[model samples]
Target chain A: MAVYTEVTDEELSAFIAQYDLGAVLSCKGIAEGVENSNFLVVTERGPYILTLYEKRTRKEDLPFFLGLMEHLAEKGIACPLPVAGRDGVALRELSGRPAVIVTFLAGMWPRRISPQHCAQLGEALARLHLAVGDFRMERPNALALNGWKDLFAKSAERADEVAVGLRTTLADELAALEANWPADLPAGVIHADLFPDNVFFRGDSLSGLIDFYFACNDFLAYDIAICINAWCFEIDGSFNATKARLLLANYRKVRPLSRAELDALPWLCRGSAVRFLLTRLYDWLNHPPGAFVRPKDPLEYLRKLRFHQSVRGLGDYFLDDSATGEA
Target chain B: MAVYTEVTDEELSAFIAQYDLGAVLSCKGIAEGVENSNFLVVTERGPYILTLYEKRTRKEDLPFFLGLMEHLAEKGIACPLPVAGRDGVALRELSGRPAVIVTFLAGMWPRRISPQHCAQLGEALARLHLAVGDFRMERPNALALNGWKDLFAKSAERADEVAVGLRTTLADELAALEANWPADLPAGVIHADLFPDNVFFRGDSLSGLIDFYFACNDFLAYDIAICINAWCFEIDGSFNATKARLLLANYRKVRPLSRAELDALPWLCRGSAVRFLLTRLYDWLNHPPGAFVRPKDPLEYLRKLRFHQSVRGLGDYFLDDSATGEA
Candidate 1:
C-alpha cells in the first residue's frame, strides 16, 4: 500500500534508457512492501520490480541491502537480483528518491502460515544467514536490544493507552531483557523482519525472500526468535507447538544452534516481541491524523510479549535438545 | 492504494482452482484503478488482472461491464477480456466481494498527454463506440444529466466552502444543462469515464483501454465531449485547441459526427463538465475523515465548466467541419 513518490513517464523513460532492459512497456505501482514505493515494471526484457526507497529506508544503508541481495543471489539463494544499469551501478535516482530495479520473483507470500510454510521458512532463514557469510558490508540491527530502551522511552508515556498495564509490563520486560540479553552468539546478516509477508512461497515450497530494507548484522538466532514470535502465534494468541517444532527443527538441521543460542531462545523471543511492540506502539501513538496506513495493533504484540514472558524455558518454544519439554 | 480485502492462500488457491488457468504463482495487489481491489495475478499460463469489485461498483452491473469487455475484445478491440472459469462464468465471489479475472494488457497509461496521444485516443474511442454498438447489454450512465442535479444537491451546501460562488454557479449551470440537454443523438455504449488513465499507450500508439466499470449506454458524442474535457485541457487550466482539433478530426475519420452532434458539442461539453464537477464536488464535500482515497479537486472541473460555458459554438472546441480553423 505504499507508492509515496509518483514517477513521471518522462522521468521514468530517461531512467530506463540508462539500462539495457528494452523500451518501457508499463510500470504499475504494486501494493507490496511497506517500506518503499514498488512498481511492477515491465519492459521488453520482461518484468522487474522498481523500488523507490521511501523515508523509512536510509539512503546510506541501500548499498548494504542491495549488495546483500546480489551476494545471496550469486550464492544460489532464491532472491531478487539487483539489475545494474549500463553504468554498472545497481542503485540510482528516480523522482528525487533512490530507486533500483530488481528481477521479479514469481510467488505470493503465504497469507495463512501453515506448519509446512514455517518449516520451509526455517530452511530459507538458515540458508540466508549462511549465504551472506562472505558478504563484505555490515549494517547494525537498528531494532535490536541496543535500540530498545530509546524506542521504549519514546512510547513510555502513552504505552498504557493501548492496553491496561501495558506501560508497566513493557518496563518490566525491557529491564529483564536488558539484564539477560545474550551476547557473543553467531552473528550475520539476518533478515530482521522475516515476517510471513516478507517470505514468499510458490504453493507450499519456499520460492524466495524479499524486503531487504530491514536486513542487518545481528544474532542470527535472534532472527529465528523474531520468526517464532511472528509465525507460531494463532489468531487467538495461543502458541502452536507443531509449527514451532517444525521451524526450529528444520532450522537446526541447516544451521545448528550453539548452546548459548539455544539457552537464550525464550528471552530472545521476549526481546523481539518487545522490540516490535515498542515500534508499533510508537507508530500507533505518533501516526498523523489522516495517515492512510492504519497502525498495526500494538496490543497483539503485547499479548505475544506476555506469552513469551510466561514461557518457562526454550522447550516451550520447541528447542529440541532442551531438558524441559513443556512449561 | 486499495486492497480492502486480504485474500488468504487457502482462499485464493481454492478460487484459482475453479479456473482453468494454471496454478497461482503470484498475486500482487496492484496500485492501479481506484474503484476496485486489483491484483496483477501471474500463473503458469501467463499474467492476468484479478479485480475484486469494492463498494463503489454495484454487483448487479458486473455482467454488463464484463459482457462489454468480452464483446469489445471479441470485436478486435484491444482491451482486457474477462476470463471465464471452467463453468463459463466470468464473475464470481472471492474474499466476500464479486471478482473477475481479465487478460492483462501490456502498456502504461500516458502520464503526460500529448497531441499525438490525444489523436490516437480519439480514433480508439470512436472505434470503441462503433464496436460496442451491437452489444446486447444496455447500462444507463449513472452520472448523466439526470444524476447531476441529485449530485449537486448533496454538495450544494458546502460547495461554496470550496470556492467563493461555487454553490450558486453550480445550481445555475445544472438548471441550464438540464433545460438544454440534447435528445436523440446517436446513442450506443459509451465509455462514460474515458479519462487518460483508462487508455493505455505504447509510445504514441494506443495499446488498450481498461476499467470498463464506468462504460454505459449514452449519447455517443457525449463521450467525445468527456474526452475533450479530459484530454484537451492543459495542466494550467487552459484549453489546448490544437490538441482538441487533432482529437476531434481523428475521431471523425473513424466515426463521423453528424451536423446535430457537431452543433450540440458545446452543450454536451458543458453537461459533461458539470457531471464531473458535481461528482467531484460531492466526493470533495462528503469525504469521510481519514479516508484513504483523496477526493479530486472539484475546482479543476469548475474551471473546465467555466471554459465550456464561455464556448461560442463548435468552433471553440475545434469541430473540424467548422470554417473557423486555427482559432
Candidate 2:
C-alpha cells in the first residue's frame, strides 16, 4: 500500500546484485515507511535494507541520505550505514527508482515517550549533533525559515478556507518571523524530522536512528525547536511542562545549548510548527485523487503554531518559571 | 495529477457526448475522495468535473452527495451533480479509482476567513444539512460518546508517557461522555471535515462542498460542535467567541439548532477536539515513514481540549453574560 513508486523486487535484486553483498538470500518488503518503499534484505554476508526512492524524496538526494547514514554509523552513531558496491558507490537505480542497500537497524520507535525516553532522546540528539560535526556534506535546510513563505504562497488562495483571517495572520507572522529569524548561530547537520517515530530503542535504551530526509544544515537551536514542537505537546495541543523539561534537560546533558539558542527556541518552534501546518494545508487543498496518501488535518499544526505564538517565553516551560515567562 | 476517474474521456464522450459539448479531456490519478474525486475534465461539453463513488457513500447513499449537489444546484448551489454515464450509471470505476464526472467547480478555497467567512461556512453547512433531507438513509452518530476512549485504546500502551494521571482522566471523561450520550435529536448526514479546505468559494459567495468522506447520519448539534472546533479557534489554539457566534447565527438562519442541540454543543466541541487530538497522537507515535503523509503534533488538540475543559461556563468565551463561566 505504501508503494508510491514503481520500484519492483526484481529491479532491486538486480541493483543490489551489483553491490557484491556476497550473495542475496532473501528480500522482503518491510512496510515501515509511509513516504518510501523499504525492504529488509538478507545476503550471504549480512542483513541489509533496500530503499526505493519515492515522491516526497528525490532520487538525486540519495547521496545526502545514504551518505549521512554511513557517516553517522562510522562515527559510532547507531544507524543504518549505506553499504557500497564493489565500485564504492552507495546508490543504484532499481525499478525505475533510485535505490540503496544499508545495514538494517533494530529497536522500535518509542510508542510511549516516558520522561526517561525523553531524556534519552534528548541526549541521543545531542550526540547526533556532535557526531554529524564531521560529516562532509553541504545541503541547505529544505524546510527552513524561508520555506514557510514558499508554502504560504501555495496555500494563499485557500488560507481563508481554513479559518477567518488566516491569510492575513499568516502574512503577519511571516513578517514577524522574518524580522526575528536568527542570523548568527552555530550551524551543523541536523535530523530535522527527529520525532519519536524516527528513533529506535531497546528495553528503555536508545538503539539507533533513521530517516535523514529532512536532515540539513541549520541552526542547532532550530533543531531543538522542532523537537519541542514534536515532543512536548499532546494531540489536544496542551503543553506539558514536565515533558518539555525532560527533553531539554536531556539534550543539554551532552550538547549544551547557547543562550542565543535558548532565546531563539520559541520563534524556531513557531516556525517549525507553522511550516508543517502550511504544508498540510497546501496538501489538503491541492491533493490529487491518485494521491497514495491521506492529507492530515492541517488544523492540528495550526494549533501548534498558535501555541508558539502565545509563547513569549520558553523559560518556565523548560527551565525556570521566571526566566521563561520573561522570554 | 488530478485524474478525472469519475468520468474518463471515453465515458464523458459517451455520457455528455450527447450534451452541449466543449473540448473533451481528462487527467489521470484522481484522488479517491470521500465525497468526490475532482477531475478537471474539459469538454466541448464545457469544462466539467467528474466525481465517482462518493465514499462512506453506499450505492444507495450516493443520492446524499449526488442528490445534495443536484438539489443545491437547483437551488443555486453552484456545484455540479453526478452526470450519468451512457451506461446509465452515475458512478463508475476508471483508472483503478472510483469516480463521477460533473462540471468542474470554479473559485478557490478562501485564504482569509473573516468572521464573515465563518458565518458563511456555518450557513452553508446548515443549508447543506437541510437540503439533503429529501433523501433518507439512517446511520448512527459517531464521535457521540465513548469514542474518545475507544481511540485512546489504540495508544493505551504509552498513555503514561505524558503523565501518571492521563489514563485515569481520559477514562473518567469517557465514562461521563458515555453517560451523557445524546439519544434523540435532529439527525442527518453531516460534512465532518468542514475545515476551510473542504469549502470552495468565489468572491464572498460559497461555491460548493467537497470531501464528504466523514459525512454520515449524526446529530445536527454534533456537526455544530465540529464547526466550533474548526471555525471558532485560532491557529494559536485560542477560542474566538465572536467567530463562533457569527457561525451559529448564520447557521441558525437556515437550520435553527434545537435547544437540546445547543446544550450539547459544548460537550460536542470538546469531543470533537478530543477526537482529532487522539487520532493525531496515534499517528505521531506510530508513523510508518512511507505513508507520504505527515503526522501532526498532538499538543495542539490537547491545548484546545484544555480550553474546552476549563470552560467554567461557555457564556464567558462568547461574552454572553448568560453563558459566562465554566459549567
Candidate 3:
C-alpha cells in the first residue's frame, strides 16, 4: 500500500524507452508492498511489475536480490525475473529511485493458510534451498541473532508500553538465544521471509514465490523455523500441529534434515519469533501514531515465542511416525 | 491509495463463481480512487477492474453509475462497461460493500495535460453529453449550488484559519453566485469531476474516461466550465487561454455551444471553482490531521475563483477570432 515516489508520465515514457517492451500502456501503483513503490505495468507485450526501490530498500542489496531471482528462475523455480532493458541492464533509475521491471507471475497469495497450502509451501521451500545451491552471492540474515540485540536496544526502554515486563522478556529471550545459538546447521541461501503473503497459489497448487528482498544466506532450517511461526499459528495464537507436521513432513520429503538441524528446530523457532517480535516492536513504537500502515501486533509473535519456550522437545513439534527419515 | 474493505480470496473465488470469467489469476488493490476499493482483478478471460464501493458512495447510486456506464459503452463510448455475472447482474454485495467488475481500459491518465489532451477531452466530453441523451435514470448534481451553501456552512467558522479573510470572501462569492447563477441552460449527464486524472490518453489519442461517481444530470456548459478550471489552469494558478480556446473550439466542432451557454461560461467557471473550493475547504477543516488521505489545498481553487472574478467577460476566456461566431 505504498507508492512513496511519484513517477510522471513524461518520466515514465522516457524511462520505458530504454526497454524493448512495447510502449507503456498503463502503469498502476499497486497497493501490495510496503517497502517499495510497485506498479502493475501493462504494455503491448504483456503485464509486468515495475518496482521503484524506496528508501527502506538499500540500493546495494538490490543486485543480490535480483541476482538470486535470476539464479532461482534459471534453476526452473517460479519467481519474478528482472526484465533487462535494451541496454542489457536489469536495474536502472526512475524518479531518483533504483527501478526494475520484472516478469509478472499469475496467482494470488493465499489469505487463509490451509494445510494443503502448508504442504505445498514446505516442498517449495525445500526446493528453493536446493535451487540456489551454487549461487555465489552472500548476504547474512540481518534480523538473526547477530542483529537482534541492537534492535532490542533501540526499543528496550519503552517495550513495556506494549505489555507488562515485555522488555525483560525480550532481554531474557535474546540472552538465552545468544548463549545457545547453533554454530553450524547446513547454511545456504534461504528465503528468510517466506510468509504466506510471499507465496502465491493458483487454486490448490503453488504458482510461485516473491519478495526476495529478505532473502539471504542463513541456516536453511531457520527459514523453515520462520515458516513454522508464520504459517502454523492461528489467529487465536494457538499452534496448529497438523499444519506443522505437514509442513515439516513435506519439507523432509524434498531435502533430508540433519540431526543437528532437527535438534536446533525449537531454538530456531524461538529465535525466529524473537527476530520478528523485535522488528515489529521497533516499528510499533516508532511509526507515527495513526499512520496508514497498521503496525502488526508484536505480542502475537511473543505468544508464539512463549509457545516455543514451552515445547518439551522435537516430539512436541513432530511425532516420530510423521518423520520422513531425518538425516 | 485506499483499500478500506478487505476482500478475502475465498470470498472472491465464490463471488467469481457466479460469473463466466475463469478462475481468478490475481487481484491487486490499486492505489487509485478515493471513493472505492479498486482492485485490478485479472482472470483467464482478461483484465478487469473490481470496485468495492466504500462509505462515501451511497448504495442507492450504484445502479445509476453502473447503468450509465453500460449505456455509454453500448453507444460506443470508450468507457468501462460493467461486466455482468451469469445471472446478468452487474451490481452485487461483496465484503458488505456494493461491488461491480468493469472491463479494464488501457492507457494511463495524463499526468501532464497538453493542449492535445485538452482538445481531445473537449470533443470527448461533448460526445459524452450527446451520447447519454436517452439515459432514463436521473440524478441531480449533489455538489452543485444547492449543496454548496450547506458545505460552506459546515466549514465557514474555521475558514479564517486557512486564510485571514477566506470566510468573508467565501460568503461574498456564494452570495454573488447565488444571485447570478444561470438558469435554463442545456443539461445532460455530465462527468462533473472530469479532472486530468479521470481522462486517459494513449499516444496523443484520448483512450477513455473514468470515475463516474460524480456524474449526474447537470448543465453541459458547467461540465465544460469544470474542465476549463481543471485543465486550463497551470500549477502557478495562471489560466492558459490557449488551452481553453483549443478546448472550446474542439468542443464546438462537435456540439456547438449556444450563445447563452457561451456567455455563461465565465460564471459557470466561477461557480465550479466555488463548488470545488467549498468541498476542499470542508475536507481541509474537518478531516483528521493524521488521517490517511491528505486533503487537497482549497486555496488553489480560491485563486482560480479570484482569477475568474477578474475576468471582464467571455472575451477574457475566448479571444476575438476563435469566438465560434457567438452573438
DockQ, every prediction: 0.68, 0.03, 0.62
Of all true interface contacts, what fraction is found in model 3?
A: 0.74
Can you write out model 2's per-residue Cα lDDT over B14-87, one digit (the tens) per residue? 55554455434322223223234444444434445555553434665555566555666776655556677556
lDDT of 1 by residue, A102-205 (tens): 99997889888899998988888888888988999989888876688889888889888888788899888888988899868889888889898888888778
TM-score of each: 0.94, 0.49, 0.95
Backbone Cα, N, C clashes tallied per candidate: 0, 76, 0
How does chain A of candidate 1 score by TM-score against the true chain A? 0.96
Which portions of model 2 show Cα errors greater than 4 Å? A6-9, A22-25, A44-46, A316-318, A321-327, B1-327
Q: List model 1 lDDT by residue over B1-327, tens digit each.
A: 768779987788889999998899888888766788998887778778899999999988999999888899889999999998999998999999998999989787888898999889888988998898789988888888768877877888888899999989988888897788887899999988899889888766799999888888889999999999999999899999989888888888788887888888899999989888888888878878767666788889989999989989876665566522221
The runs of at least 3 residues in candidate 1 whose Cα sits more than 4 Å from the true structure, single-residue gaps closed, are A318-327, B317-327
Per-model B-chain TM-score: 0.96, 0.79, 0.97
Ranking by TM-score: 3, 1, 2
| TM-score of candidate 3 versus the correct structure, residues matched by position | 0.95
Global lDDT scores for all candidate models: 0.86, 0.68, 0.89
RMSD of each: 2.5, 25.1, 2.2
lDDT (10s digit) by residue, model 3, range A1-327: 777788888898888888998798888999887788999988888888999998888999999999999999999999999999987999999989999999999988988889999999999999999998899999987888768989999999999999999999999999899888899989999998889889999888999999999988989999999999999999999999889888988889899887788888999999999999999999989988646666789999999999999987888865443234542
